[model samples]
Target: MIVLDYPYVSKFLVESVRDLGLPVLDTPQVRELAGGVPLDYIDEIEFSARLALGGKVYTNSENGLEHVLRCRCNEDLARQVDICKDKALFRETVANLHPDYRFLRVSHAGLSGLDLSDFPVPFVIKPARGFFSLGVHVVNDLADWPATLEAIETERAALNAEYPEAVVSGAEFILEQVIDGEEYAIDVYYDAEGNPVITNILHHHFLSAADVSDRLYYTSARIIETWLLPFTEYVRDVGRECGFNNFVTHIEVRVTPEGDILPIEANPLRFAGWCVADITNLAWDFNPYECYFKELRPDWDAILEANKGQAVVMVIGDLPPGTDRESIGSIDYQGFQSMFSNTLELRKIDYKAYPVFAFAFARMDEPELARLKLALAEDFCRFVKMK
Candidate 1:
């Protein structure tokens, strides 16, 4: 069963839900999006009963996490959600996996009075239940605290109103040492037996140390062959830690200079948000939703053979903060599309309700790595004519 909610849904997902005839939890948002699409829609009562009876579940966005919590009758599943939702709690559950990594949690109201004399410089501070890069900041110097604090508060005010607290909590925050490495995102699910099957692995690309934006992520065949087993094993360990089964997660981690895998966080019950999971189709010719719902696992050996020498990228054209959403404007989507030679898909989002303008998926070769760097550095506001 799937429970989808605001702020965004994708055509790919709606079609997949239709094709598979999966039972969708009936809600105005899902009805608004999936109505007349021939989906199997079920009411809350039936949905909750099915979930309690051990039905496998998936949600398109964390915004739907509220539904899961309310309908949750399984204490173990609820515990898993808590461990994944609360970053401080997550750090505790997995402490045995990395005992030296330190993290501290403080209430939102307590951040200002908190003394950081004992904490290390260059640490990351973010909402304990953050999603996307909202409210996430890297503090490099003591002088930057006031400005960073101001930014966090501004973000907190918006988040507390804009999303469900279960999705992005504004009350509590986590401060942890930065894990320096090339970051990677993995989309994997554990079967009924708790064995993990990876669907996709993406490299999170950034322009510099202070960059926390999710502007660019790309995947290739070589990455799958190299990191698949190690990441799968790591996720298996995490499942054991949480007693996870019949679960799906999109996990982020850093591969340190010394080749250590340090976890960043995990977004449970979904693949990448906002249909970034669809990039799996653009990259490997299979839908992640189809894989999870149908319990189908990719034959990695055969997949890597056909997917070599290609890079499929998920490029987010995020509108900068402070852009007036109601202002009259026109976007030069064509100008952005012209940057890629082989565009796989271009999804224009409702930036009026959400912060992103578009999600562009493209296929590139090794020589075009510089082009991705250009995308990473883009503000994308230049393409917008605000009145």
Candidate 2:
């Protein structure tokens, strides 16, 4: 039996598990299916009890529910997850592992009364535990500090207003040195024996001159062809240092022009947001959810050998400032696809607030594909208008 919980109990994931002919229960539906379950609200204690009923539990979401199971099943993994969620802990843990492991100097700050006089120029300000790039800003210099705080505060306020239950009240913000390099996300899952398996490596394309808002990401079979050896070793080292095993890890890394790789952060148990891991099925003919639950260790050498010459890209539909879901009508899919001849999938996201996100998958080669990604990010608004 497999128990699914909130944020992870998506139709895509549930159906995928059912396809395996396994008995899966979504936490929320437990009472509906079993009338006497006595689960009034779905929470860590309730979900933890369900997990004790005998089979494996799985969740892609980082919410407390996942951590509850981890705490019960694997204390070390739970620690790793907690550390990853807190950026400061993650930085300190990794940096203490090796002398070469470098992280930018970071200090906690509040929305009001933040001082930047002694801080380095061009630093980054973000919540210690942040998601979807909310409350993230680049402080160019002392002059940009005020605007940066205002932007973060405004975004945080709007988010809290819309989702009061998920408020970030009294959340600690961290200011850190910004790395200069191209960003990339490496998705991997480690087996029970702690061996790392690389699922897919995505090149994160962001708006130039702006440090936030990843506009698009491109993943290709060639990623394994190019960085399989070194990247895997790097991840394995990080995993060992972080003391994580039998877990899903999404590592955000920065690659410099001189070929140095520095980790930005590690997100556990969840691949890219919004079921983006499903894109791997189109790119590699494998299901990530199945791989994790079934403890399948991929034969990367063989998988890469077979799936050469394949590529997939995901474009994010970021809502412009001052725009909400009600204001934006719909995406011009026809016009959008016309720009990329190899478009595989395109869809507009229905979001409640600003910074709305959607994804477009495509098959194309790099260098050329890089240009198309930029064009899509720049011209995304052209395809969306007021309702």
Candidate 3:
């Protein structure tokens, strides 16, 4: 059963749900979001029965998580969700796996008075329960502390107002050591038999060390070839440790230069937060949702061969800081697409309601690494107009 909840839902997911004939958990959001589109919807009672029978579930957004959690009849399912959602609990749950990793959870109020002299420096700090990198900041030095705290303080109240405490909160934050390595995001699920099956993996490309924005992520034959088994096995162990199965998860990790894989954070029951999971379909000709529903493992040998030396990139057209959304007249999507070597798909977003101009998918050859770099450095403001 699928739960369609707030923030955003992609057109591809809606079409996938209909084609697969999966039952959606009926709610007002279904009527509002799907409108007259045909769908199979199961109510709370029916959903509960499916859980009792070990039916697998998926959600398009974390905002819908509360509904799924509230109606689930299994205690283990709820525990899995809680452990994945709360960063503090997630760290503790996997503490033994990396006993030397440093992390501390502090309330929002305590941040101002906390002493940082003995605390870990060059760490990433963000809301304990965060989404979309709202309060995330990387401290490169002790001198950046006051500015970081001030930024969080200035943005804290708005964070609470903009989202449900369930989806995102400003009550507490987690400080942890920064793992230095190329980062990747995985869209994987534990099958009914409790084995992890990975569908797609994206290499999250950043402009610099201090960059935390979801600006650029790309998947290629090379990315899958490099990290597939290592990530699958790592996540499988984490799932086994947490007693998880019959679910979908989007995980991020940083691999050290020594070839060490450090678990960053896992988002349970969803993929890549919005419908960015559709990049799996765009890149590899398979829907991530379909993999979870049908319990199918992708034939990577064939897929990588077909996509050898090719890269499909997901770019988030993030709005520049302090841009007045109220004065935004339009986004020049055409001008934006011109930056890439070969454009695959471009999705224009409703900036008044959300934080981005668009989500784009592009295909590039190895020689186009320079093209990806150009796109990354492209001033999004050049493509946006003010009223």
Candidate 4:
């Protein structure tokens, strides 16, 4: 029997597992007494590194036995990719790999004397590796490049003085033409056998314009069949060539006006936060953890089967100016529910507050979702309390 520290496991994940009658071991005391779960002692980053190295682990915690499932093949692949604070490399990599794909070419602030108004509106500007929206600016003209570049430089200087380690000295900022399209995430999951199966596709909406972080919705199987499969194949080939197999990859993409799908960037990690949970509830009728356990699969066919013609609504805050989480009080969940009971699946009661919160998610009825979506938009109007 394996024992593990409970603290290392996610509470929501553990609870879901516990609800089932599966055999397991957990709790820090028991783990401490029994020797400890196989990998609980390692820090998260270290754990991720070790797992990437083809490590196989078995341990139990406050929840039960959790198999640190990973592909045994590509353990040392992490060492191959050069990690640096260079944004030029990012642009170069994309251009080199997919020359035909529409992309924004970026030049350094000092190097390029391009006009913003001369180009086009809604182009993106940021330091190769920028934080927040500090060094990021969006302008619609080539004429505005001078001012925007100035803004970028000022922010860059401030960041260098304040958080030197976060920015590489003499870092070059790049301005790229932003693509027009809906944003989505492709969640890559490797099965126990080492095959990369796209678990879910999600639509991402942002918490705020400044941050540019997004809320997500599970992609219907139909959407995947129509749009995602080809892209999936493309990435699969690329990832395999890059020696990335048996791990999760979050690829951000946009669908263009020409109906072309273009990948913006890819994260070599799982989508952090409740996003995994959100995708789980709407598409699978169970969240990611439950899918991990393969339990309570209410609609196994529907879950795995794509394009069952369903949709999920993600609610996010467009908070009024000067208001924050502490300022609001006595929020009414019931009142909110009365507005959109039909499609409501999960509500994001509070997501870190401030500029990016007050959101709800509704699972629109599959093959029958339109009416519910309308109901939600009409019925839901209660202000979420800040405090």
Candidate 5:
């Protein structure tokens, strides 16, 4: 049975697995574990207090299931921050863990010694333990620190009152050094036993010109070369060191200003998004969602070699309310089906759903590939219009 986390992530997984004709266990598997089944039965578990009782729990190495649950990493890269009651430890650990990483600590009061007047802004600030971009602010001028800190403090106080348990152990704000470089997301898979295999490299594009943005604007496979393979290998090594395997990891990274790839964050047991399988299926001839459930691996070399010119474009836009299928024209079930017979692979297209959108997996034969990619993306987005 396929188990999932919360409903948002679970719905997509359940639907995709069902589409592949598989039975799914919809209940939160954590409940089952609490009820007395062994820990290994749980495929993935997020961090929580009950499981960490007295700081030890049983884990099965054979299936690499233990890594699926949140552990030390949740506290921060240094294993110092506790998801519950350890904010001060978190700030201290994060700073100590990777002093080289771009880090900035924000607070109700400005962080001492980080003057913004200096050129080449080096850091950013936010609530120490904020979510969904709350209280996240960037400071370039030392002059702006006080104002920014005051606003964050106000927000932090409100959040603490509402979610005392969620508050960080320390009252200090989040300070992060900006990692300057291009951003790329690596889709990685670990064997049931927890060894990683690089699947694909997808470039994420942001609609906003600003440097700090959370929501993903668009994604496509732009380039993959032999040099990047080593980068993927390094990520695997890091994952192994962390004691996690048998899951999908969305590792965000930056091509450092010095031409080195440095990891921004590693999500141990989560897919980048529900759309990953769709991107791989459309751009390449393989399906990751299928791979996960069926325990199969696609020949990456062959797929890359065969579909060298193909790319997948994710439409970045919002769907208004009351939108319906008629806006996009009749679902050309037959015409749409015809692409698979050709070289094109259309990933998941939900015409009947809100925020109506479709992705075109197109192949081009010339150096004019860039132009063709845009044309195809436009057609795909237009064809699935939102009212």
Candidate 6:
């Protein structure tokens, strides 16, 4: 029996699991159309108790849900997840394994008394336990430190106001030396036997040279053709060093101009956020959800053969501050369609605040991609309003 939880069990995942001839016990919030044993009447504790009796429990839920699962179900899984969520802990773990890895931890009280003179310029600052890029800031020099702190303070206030229980609330922050280069994220699952299998690698495109906001991500067959071997080997080494086994992780890394790779962080018990991993279906004709539960490795040779040179970019729409879902009157679908003729999917997220999420996918070249990205941003501003 397979146990699934809230915010993680999607229709696609449920249907895919059923297609594999497996039985599932899903949380109440999941749509009934997915055809699972519904457990909506019971609370998370009861749900967890029921899940513990099952053979394999599957969840993509982060933060609170994850903590509950760790406490009620699996201790090892919890430890691994905790290690990943705490940037300082993650850095220590990696540094212990690899001498070159390093990061600094700052307490909440220390933020006011931080001495920036000793540290190098151009460092990255983020909450020790954070999500959705909340409280993330880049400090280019001592002069920028104050602004960065102010931004973080504002972000923390907004986040705490909106999500009082978020991990970012009242959490210490960590600072790491910024590694300049291209960034990439790879999703992996280590099976029951502790063998790691990589499912997908996405190339992250930022909004600008100075801005670190992830505006777009593209997956292509070229990742496998170029970086599969070395990247996978590196992940395996990290896993071995960290004693991670029977886990699912999303790992981010920076690749220097000379081709040196440095890990940013590891997020455990999930592939990517907001169903981004589903892009594999279009790129590889494979279902990662099924692969994880069934412990199956993708047919890389066939997938690579069929998708050579083909790419799918997922353009994320993060609107500027003060923009809310109600602010947007309606999406001009026709105008949007005309702007990006190659668009495969487009939808605006129903959310409360700034960084309102929307996304579109397309297969196009560099110039077209840039144009489509700009057009999407503009269309969002044009169609949405301050209500």
TM-score of each: 0.97, 0.83, 0.96, 0.61, 0.57, 0.86
Q: Residue 175 CA error for candidate 5 (Å)?
A: 1.8
Each candidate: how many clashes?
Answer: 0, 1, 0, 23, 16, 0
TM-score of 3: 0.96
Predictions: Cα RMSD each: 1.3, 4.6, 1.4, 8.0, 9.1, 3.4
The candidate with the higher lDDT, 2 or 3, is 3
- The ten-residue window of minimal lDDT in model 5 covers 55-64
Report lDDT (CA) for all predictions: 0.86, 0.65, 0.86, 0.47, 0.46, 0.69
Between candidates 2 and 6, the one scoring higher on TM-score is: 6
**Which portions of model 4 show Cα errors greater than 4 Å?**
1-11, 14-53, 56-91, 100-122, 130-136, 144-172, 190-195, 205-218, 257-259, 286-307, 318-339, 343-354, 366-387
Q: Write the per-residue lDDT of candidate 5 for residues 34-114, one digit (tens) a residue.
A: 343222232223233323332222111111222323344333321311221222233343343355554444454455554
Cα lDDT, model 5, residue 368: 44
Candidate 1 per-residue C-alpha lDDT over 319-365 given as tens digits, one digit per residue, 9 for 90 to 100: 87688978838778998787788998898888787777888999988
For model 3, the run of ten residues with the poorest summed lDDT: 370-379
* 10 residues in a row with least lDDT, candidate 2: 161-170
Candidate 3, 219-325: lDDT as tens digits: 88988998898988998888887777887899898899999888889898998887899999999998889888998889999999998999888899988888899
Output the lDDT of residue 279, model 2: 72
Compute the lDDT of residue 378 as modeled in candidate 5.
29
